[model samples]
Target: MSDQKPSPLSIGDFATWEPVLRLLWAGSEVHHAGRPARVAGRIGRRSWSLNLRTRLPSPGRAAQVEDIREEVDAVKRVRGALADAGVDDVSFTAEIQPSGEAVLRLLGPSPAVEPGIGTPYPGALILVDGSLPEPWRRLPDPVAGAVPAPSADLKLLERRLREGLPDAVGATEEEITAAEARLGITLPAELKVLYRVTRARWEDYNDDHEAAGRESAAVGCELFDLDALYIADASSRHCRWEFAAMEAVDTPPDAAVQGLVGSPGWIAFGDTGGGDRLAVDLTPGPRGHIGQVIMLSHEESIGAALVADSLTDLVLGRPSTRSSSARGQRPPATAWVTTASLKNVQAAAHPGLEALSIGVWDSAPLSLAPFTGLPRLRTLTAYPGTLADPLEITELPGLEFLQLGPQEWRVLLDARAVPRSLSAAAIVVHGNQDPLPVVALANEILALWDRPRIVQTVLEGAVGPGPGAQPGADRRSGGTPQ
Candidate 1:
């Protein structure tokens, strides 16, 4: 793909996808009229599948653009299609004709599922509307008689700002009130005081970079304008289901800051200039003050680091002395069964557990009895043949997302034991397994919810034979293969 953004391709037109389809056909080891060559892959707005194998870069050397330029260009066309369609990602399958004409089909998910993370397939099923992961649903513990830190000196902060920015424009009382109403939460006293001293708007700097730099230096961070102030809640931080489902919230009793994805009390008012957010924490941990300062790191998915005891201390260049670290290992919210990770299912069984993944194991197949009636368990994914009995999944009552092999799914479907509680599902495809059967199984799951089935749009177009187009290797590749 070009570094610069290109115009979106015609999503509904076959010509836009011919190049991509041709590339897939070229790379296929098996392509003939008697056998319909199968190609399956997913493409997202920001990511896509590059199934073609290219030479690995030499040691101590980065890959050159030419290494996978053809693959990147091929996937970029699909990305353009996603943009034109206004969907996050799309999973598709195609079959090549002997004359080089191809039959292409795109997968359309129902409204019941969120867009799958990094895949073209359907994401987590929404059995119930407005359903959220356990971590996102957590609220901070309320503290009685919580007081602001002694370092919170409103007068001193305002005085310092005024002295440093004599010609700066401050926000009016009405502007501050409007911001509070927009956020649906009262601004902390120190934050309000800081805003009153200087609104931190670009207009205040008159588009002068030097003036803006001076204000950032004076305030200790790139402060947001009054109108730009927003509540740092879970909704503000977008996390995909695959990762979000694995996370758990834990706040130690003695800690000074809550361990959460985002909190209602975290009022984002400034930037750390490195993509992280600076917020005034109103919902402080047990030992924390009412209005302490915290920095939400961009690189992390959950929790914030203590920047200072108070906003006043932040401006005054004082490091936070309060200890926010939790002492012991947190309850395992996500578990993996494999030789490299957790060795057994018993070790992972806990009331707090949410997502369980059974990877390639050399030991005997395991049972789901250990997770029976576990209140929080929502996601379960097992490698093919790792489960002793596929019917044992019925014991897990709260499963929302389940990924299992086609054989296991057959057991559940034949026995009429498919869980009614599932919000989303996936088939663990192995080797050169056919996708038609997998799609058939996926339709069965969607049928349970009365959701729309995945529709296949077949398009006929001639693109000639591919480079590696030959017989004998019927390979299937795409998505994060389970």
Candidate 2:
């Protein structure tokens, strides 16, 4: 044996395994027990090695090891199958640990395999390790709650990550600055790092980008976690708070600021100027259930008011399970807008109204004439219940964003009337209607316009089972609205 000891490997060496494990678990019934699977290796090169360790349930050690070995053989067999099926340079190795768990390693040029290849076997533990590129490390953790059928479009992980920031943890300005001063280093760069990984989770749901502004104002110092000090500095635009993970503050492309500071991860900020920072903590509670909570704090005088306002806004924006009456009783409103409330407003005919989001209301036809006279009324979303010839949308010259329900589409199609100067329009057809009629109506609407930048036609089943079902049943059925 050589006298020199083996060089220690860096965390980057085992990067590929993370994505592979994510792919394996995507849409599968695997549970990640919170313990990170160990990985040791460099990816893509033959010399790179991989090791993964996981615990197996106690009952069947020998049989489990044999089954794991067969599973490894199955992966190798699948690689050969992919090659036979015209995929190239694909190879993998799998082995069972002494503890009756499985470890998988990709040996060469990574194969393009379907994300959900292995059939899920209950009670089997999975651990994957490899050396992958940095880009692979950034892949979002597979959706945690439940698994859907495998999709050929693996970019769904990317989509979820893009949608919003993950939960985060935050600290005050004085707390962070004191820590930095104690460390004898200026804290600008460190603060930026923490914001980048955890900012996206918040941004996806922010709707107006106001939360981003709030986050930047509050995160003023550096904090440490995962062996890295996440930096939050207001002065440096490059380090300005973002949702996506960042490697360095000086990286270019100003547009990336939104992604870096907003991506999902724990974040801490200093409240130097009395602004409150929001942080999400994803820690396990007593029974091993993962718990997430958001914390906000501001200075003594205005802090309480600011906290109340921010919390109210955040809570109201989220989808809630409580009834409107119950939710409205609280200090902040968290209930979905109701048709009765909307119609009541129209009946009252408030002169102050400029724009209305009528999409959520049940169909009740009201003439557009009253809205048209109001100089400021520029947007209307009406879902008139299953009735034809209720109102003429074209009468409103100032209308910009028009949302029509299935009944309205039928009326518009039958009348062969197309509105002029429409900036954007969305039409949703009911599930009860034959698909052919909806398709035909959509075709007719498309033909009426020339090069319209914003037009969408959706089928009812595609939107989810018609609202109003047993509690919790509705949750599983709804497809994302386009």
Candidate 3:
């Protein structure tokens, strides 16, 4: 309705997906002589999503199975189709008739969707353009009175670097200016001094491995060159919506670094050998110094740990006064509303809440009135039949991600009440259901966003009845067919 059209989803030729259907017909067990055998899978740019019965290799090489070499090759062939179609992922369902005919249906290339997590079904559907998770949208709080720490001495940092790497090449003023222009941020005084002492350029070392190692040791981390410096913003760190929606940002009063996904002022300067980043924090915490040093660990999703009070302390091998014990007082941002969890929506309703997952409920259905206008609430996932009324979803103004059962989505679709504020959405399927109808439902949701529809292709070919297992008979059992 907004006239916002998503990019085209190009459907590749039939030959592009044919080999996979052939492999599916050959690989799966045929359960009946009279009925068609069905097999379904999802394919992404890099990997294939195969079911447990498909029998691929396990981590321990323990699962019993047939040779999966051809299955892997077949998936690779379909990946080529994804590449050709210019989409990152797609899903398919194939039917092999007892009469040796086969039909393969390619489910998507929907620009609005992301690949589901370990499921044959699709993931979050991006309902709005350029929408990001709440945590990603949060900017660091400004500490107006913050000043450089006592240890932040640019002269001492340059002097220490000169003492250690006397033969190292430093960055020219023009090169530093060019880097600042490219990144659109001015380098801190201490950082500028460190770069001036040694640019950390490989060409400067004339391919000398020892020289690079010496520079790294002198800098107390693997220092990046002036040109390599970048702002560690939220856009720089990519996380899937399913996981990102569950995170919350909280900066403690005593923290030296702001608790954020990333910041425009957090200039990454080096790495701590084990894939962690060392950044100069211009957007410091409440009691923190303006140019404190923070380490962005690779393992965590949000926030940085104070590595040192300043870059001068880093080079001098001094520890930060801020301790990790001071940071765990924030309220829970994600809440689970279910029989086993919080018990009810009213119990989980809090101003700090960001995501709420409504699981299987044994009692009467619940209402959405408890969460009507909660400003920070962005994600909501309710199990099938748990909601008293699906139309209550319209009252949630800030919801960016919504996951409901197919029928709930249908209720919203028919009433034309699907929230326009949603950035992404999903249909939660509990039991075995036909994927065709589900794909159709997904298309309706995509249509609302003006996203390309999942192209359905019907291909017919001879696929002989798969080897010997009959309907109601387990081939491994020492019993007669029922």
Which of the numbered candidates is closest to the native, going by highest TM-score?
1
Q: How far is candidate 3 from the true structure (C-alpha RMSD, Å)?
A: 8.4
lDDT of each: 0.77, 0.32, 0.79
Q: Which sections of candidate 1 miss by over 4 Å?
A: 1-9, 31-36, 53-82, 114-121, 329-331, 428-433, 465-482
> Candidate 1 lDDT, tens digit per residue, 71-119?
7887777677677667776667777765565666666645655654444
- Report the error of model 1 at residue 391, Å: 1.9
RMSD of candidate 1 to the truth, in angstroms, is 5.4
lDDT of 2 by residue, 85-198 (tens): 343332233222222133443322212111111111001001112211121123223223422112212243223323443434344455556655654444332232333333
Q: What is residue 322's positional error in candidate 3, in angstroms?
A: 0.4
Q: Root-mean-square deviation of each candidate, in angstroms?
A: 5.4, 23.6, 8.4
lDDT of 3 at 228: 84
Give the per-residue lDDT digits (tens) of candidate 3, residues 332-419: 7789888887897887888888899999999998999999888889899999999999999998888889889999999999999988
1 or 3, greater by lDDT: 3
Task: Identify the runs in model 2 with alpha carbons over 4 angstroms from their true place.
Answer: 1-345, 357-364, 386-391, 413-416, 451-482
- 2 versus 3: better lDDT goes to: 3
Q: Name the candidate that leads on lDDT.
A: 3
Write down the worst ten-residue block by lDDT for model 3.
473-482
Q: Score residue 347 of candidate 2 by CA lDDT.
A: 52
**Residue pairs clashing, model 3:** 127-423
